[model samples]
Target chain A: MILPEKTIERLSKYRRVLINLNFQQKDYIYSHELANLIHITPEQVRRDMMLIGHSGTLRRGYEVKQLIEKINSIIDGNTVQYVTLVGVGNLGRAMLNYLKNKNKYLQIIACFDNDQDKINKMCCGIPCYSINEAEEQIKKLNINIAILTVPTNVANEVADILIKAGIKGLLNFTTMPLKVPSNVYLEEYDMITSLEKVAYFTQFIE
Target chain B: MILPEKTIERLSKYRRVLINLNFQQKDYIYSHELANLIHITPEQVRRDMMLIGHSGTLRRGYEVKQLIEKINSIIDGNTVQYVTLVGVGNLGRAMLNYLKNKNKYLQIIACFDNDQDKINKMCCGIPCYSINEAEEQIKKLNINIAILTVPTNVANEVADILIKAGIKGLLNFTTMPLKVPSNVYLEEYDMITSLEKVAYFTQFIE
Candidate 1:
């Protein structure tokens, strides 16, 4: 069975909750109870589990240990993949800080910036290098994922450099859409579009 | 005709592109061209327009002036709402700065923080008040929409406060599921959950 894109996202979240519960040594859980934590129907949880090929008991929603193992196996807990940030702006820096302390599964190994003052320095113990050193540093650091935090005007340009440097996945934060090779994957996060949608949704509140 | 939820979001984005084109005084945009700008299919743009019932000429695609007029009319331009911020953390402050000066449609009229040093100071000319004064400030400012950026530990508690203050719509950034009334709409923007989902999707990349 194949999981849908949106369902995989929910699976990651469900895994997170299960991980927390596992730490607390909480054994039994009901679909209705898990649904209450996630603000969704218990039936929806069961349906999502089916996408990932997990079967649950009637009274109990899912086995916490078994569910965590299933989700982890599906989520890919193999070799650690290192990621690099391309820009050092406000949003980029915030992401840099977040990636450093959070996400034990992922590591932000290096950062690239054109700013001379920001170069040759360490932010939260991660090295920052000139954009010219990208290819060299990527090989040196074994970084596979590139987080594009550069400005819109240069997003595609930097993306080309990252792709050429052999980055497999790109997490793009710029408003500009990068023209990438079909082999490389792109995920964009545009705050403007998200907030505007929030503003629009506010209009329909009953 | 009432706009679908997704269509409303696209229309909000379309408005921005139209504003850009209007500044350049360009007339007659093609659906394909708008699709490129907004990163959607031409068929999607047409379907969105159909949802709004704002008919545009096939040759013209959608007239910039005419489209703006229809959108504004449907969106109720007279009463632009104010959005309140409940936390003064990095994410909350970043949201304030991100939303500030991006668009003039909605304003961050007030911000709340429990820290004494952060309270009463002007953040981008919008005053920050104490969390204790949240209900009073919400009523005084007549704000209906709120963007909750508090830590996950206190997200539910703060949401209860905002709901009590007559907040109709909430854009929650915490990972926790809130138990608000059916009338109060909630949307979560948890970065940890989002990034984990990204990690899950990373496997699908060829």
Candidate 2:
């Protein structure tokens, strides 16, 4: 069953925390204990577990390994999901380095840029191809998700190209808003807006 | 009047779009036109404007310049808000470069890191001080907001120092969860969760 976007994100977080708990040799975790780790309410955690059709014993609570496996199956499915990055600029390079080997199921297999210098070079061990080769590379590599870090002027242009090349999901980091087809799942992340929101909230905090 | 966090973020987005519209010589915009630009519903835009106590004329729609001025006052007070970055890693440097001179009212004045080799260096024209000097620098800079990009192991350790140094707001980029006092505004942005959410939704789109 398809879950809400927010629930999926929380499940991913829960899996990350549970992995750490499992590493620490913790066998099981109460809903409140897990909730405290991620700063979510116990009621919310229980609701998510219920939505995922998982139940825990009153004595031992939810099994850490079992919960993680359930979330993994829900979010990632079976095969590894291949991703590509478009635009090898500062943000793109930073993302490439940070996400190089971070995920087990999700991998950034390649990157594309219009810069002559960046093309044909390796960034964080991922080969950078010219924008001209993006379609061929995407199709050859079976890449469905793309992380877009191109300039604002060329963001939509690059997005259109990526979508036409069979990209089903896009994570946009450009300052400008992009208009994509309804079939494409788009996630827009704006650092400026995030910073501004933090700044705005600080006033009420004090 | 205080606005909800989501509304504040949308206000920031609307201002960005409005500034672009102002640059294009557009003077008036209806709620629907503004909503279309940001992919939000027209009613939501109208409600946000109403919350901020702004009105539009039926004949000409909302005056772009007036709305921008009103939003500016609501989001940002008269004085500029100073910000600091912790951990001058790849993500931090990219943020500094991308944010330098980008916002008139918000400025990232300084950054802190524990690496002695990077200490006392200028990154993107902002000074990189030793993390040991974070408290002094934060107090001297009158910084109320901080962007945390430190390693996951040391994120909370550094956050504690930053809190003691007078930072009222935090934007955490670490994978680990942070626990802050209620008076401290914290925004956690986990890129892994964001990417996973996009990947999960892509399956349903097709």
Candidate 3:
């Protein structure tokens, strides 16, 4: 069953919240309680839960562990997905360090960079290869997804290479608006845009 | 004018694209051309421009420079907004380096960290202070905005302090769900959720 993009996003968020609950040894969670934790309405939470075909009893609410498994099955296919990181610049390196081994299923196996000095070096124990070797390394490692942190000038050019190398999805960090093939999924983490959003809203307060 | 959130986001995107066009020595741009660059519908672009009280001519479209100035006037208030970065960890340091002087309107003037060793040291020429001094420093510097890059466990605690420090807005990078007062604007940059979205979409490709 194909789910809407918004639903998928919420499912991921729900899984995170459930994991935290599980860590705290919480066995069950009411829809409204979970909604409050994530700052969403109870109706939206119920709607998302229904989309995953999981219904909670009125008394027991949602079984934390079981709900996590259900959401994982829908989103992660219950398997580990290997990802690659391109560009080991400041932002890229920061992401590499922060994301290392954080998730059980989603792992960044290798990284690619154009800097000859960084090539053949390991960043946070992940092997760094030259951009020239990105295609070969991706295929060898079976990498289908990539996080792009290169500069804006070379973002699209490098994206072209990644797409041609058979990457199925991209998490873009550069400011450039990348044009990927329709078959490839693209998610942008535009920091400037987000910061500006905060700036725009803060103006109304004062 | 109380523009919608989505329109504000689009306006930020439009400003970036227009800046790039201006850098390339292009003066005017049609709505369709701008939409194509940002991968949005021409109608959406037109609607956003209308919200900001700007319009394009039939022949010359919109003057790129004028549009940028108009958007900046609305979003940035034609003056610089001072911001602070909390937690000078790897992510915080990278953000400090990446955002330093990138915008004339937005500046990260001070940073806060709990580490006593890092306090009183200069990072990227910005002074680092102990987390205990955040509130006083925030008021002293007249900073109303902050970027929270602290660990997940301490995210909410630090955020609470920031809110109490009179921070009007925050760009949250931690995975933890933060609870702030209604008057405090919060924007979360959840990288894990974003990566999972890519992972979910990549499943359908194969």
Candidate 1: Cα lDDT at B129 = 95
Instruction: Give me candidate 2's interface root-mean-square deviation.
Output: 1.6
What lDDT does candidate 3 reach at residue A89? 95
Question: Where does the lowest 10-residue lDDT sum fall in candidate 1 chain B?
Answer: B15-24
Q: Write the per-residue lDDT of candidate 3 for residues A167-204, one digit (tens) a residue.
A: 99999999888888889999997888889889889888
Q: Among these predicted structures, which one has the highest TM-score?
A: 3
For residues B32-62, could you state the per-residue lDDT of candidate 3 as single tens digits? 8999988989999888887778987999999
Report per-prediction Cα RMSD to one decimal. 2.8, 1.9, 1.7
lDDT of 2 by residue, A68-118 (tens): 888888888856889998888888889888876767778899999988988
Please state the error at residue A156 of candidate 2 in Å: 2.0
lDDT of 1 by residue, A1-206 (tens): 44666787677777766664453387667777777777789888888777778887887657788887787777656546688888987677767876565666677889999999889998557789999999999988988788888876688789989888888778887766556677776776666666666666667776
CAPRI accuracy category, model 1:
acceptable
Model 3 segments beyond 4 Å from truth?
Answer: A21-24, B21-24
User: Per-candidate DockQ versus the true complex?
Assistant: 0.44, 0.66, 0.70
